[model samples]
Target: MSLRQTYRLWAPMYDVFLKPATRSARAKNLAQLGRLDGLNLAVIGIGSGLDLDWLRLHARPAQCIGLDITRAMLNKAQIRRRDCPFPLHLIEGDAMQTPLASGQFDYVVLHLILAVVPNPAAVLAEASRLLRPGGQILIFDKFLHPQQKAPLRRFISPLLGLLATRTDVEFEPLLAAHSELTCVRDEPLLARGWFRGITLQKHPINQHPINHHKD
Candidate 1:
């Protein structure tokens, strides 16, 4: 079965297996999103809407949007949304190419998706495209530090990918490739040193040179 299919089967048991990590990441990331009362936020790989509770604590559900590719996962998220204290926009869509308008969100959340998604660069690009200039992206996932080397793990990464996640995604290069994105914060979130909470900000549009048309 494909990775999406595997995740579809795991959807029912997803929260049970990931609750601890999810809770910790949520608290850490949410702490960085201070005073979210009026900001529009989008959770790119919203999964089963597990972060809804944390988001609601900081902002109203109306200010939040959730997106994911899998319908099964979205179905579970719908259940979660129904139980939420307020309503939120939940759309079944791909992170690399979501239906959300450009510069629509003041903040974009990318929790545990870098390794799960096939093209991390494309995903980041889309997130950047969706975010308003100067907006921040809160990313929580397992990734190798730019300077670290893991030859053995890299060799087995393909086998690991069979289970639905890549084992060795390096964050620095991805951030470096995007001139508009700057890594403002990076810290280890899980004790094993495998997972991290990173915050990146997209530079304002005017930061780049503009081409003017002759009047």
Candidate 2:
């Protein structure tokens, strides 16, 4: 089944299963935003608007945009919109390539999304694209460390990926490809370091140092 269809099927029970496990991690990651008084934020792959629940408890932002591929998931998110202090806009779209303009957001949240997509690098690139210089991307997901031997995870990743999310993705390579993005914080959140909370900042235009190689 396609990822959209799979998630559409899971949408009805998504919160029941995910909320308990993710609540504390979500709050901790969102806390990294520091103050949300007037920032423009995008929550990519915002399934069921669980993060919105957390935002409702805090200072309001100027606006928050949420994009997800599954219509059912977006529908559930709509119910959470009623209580948001900030303007919350939900769009049915792909995370890999969104319609939103580049450099328009002050913050981008990628909660439980990187490993779920077919091309995580593309999603990360898109998140980076959406951020203004000095904007930050907050990521919370499970990732495998480079050269770490996890045979079972690698073996089942394909099947699990088809069902919901991939289990074999590595975070380093994704971040490495985007020279403009710099990792400011990375810490283990759950599952004995399998899941991580990472924060990345976009460097100002022409400010990231370039490498020089002698030939």
* Best by the lDDT measure: 2
Q: Over the stretch 1-215, how does candidate 1's per-residue lDDT look in tens digits?
A: 67678779879989888876569766876677745544678988888878876665555523778898888888888887875655578888889888889987878999988888778999999999998887888998889877778887678778777677888888888888899888888888885777888988888746532222211
Q: What is the C-alpha RMSD of each candidate to the true structure, in Å?
A: 6.5, 6.4
Give the TM-score of each candidate: 0.88, 0.94
lDDT of 2 by residue, 115-173 (tens): 99999999999999999888889999999999999999999999999999999999999
In model 2, where is the ten-residue run with the lowest total lDDT? 206-215
- Kindly report which residue stretches of model 2 are placed more than 4 angstroms away from their true locations once superposed: 205-215
The TM-score leader among the candidates is 2
Q: Rate the local accuracy (lDDT) of all candidates.
A: 0.79, 0.91
Model 2 residue 168 lDDT? 98
What is the Å distance of residue 88 in model 1 from its true position? 1.1
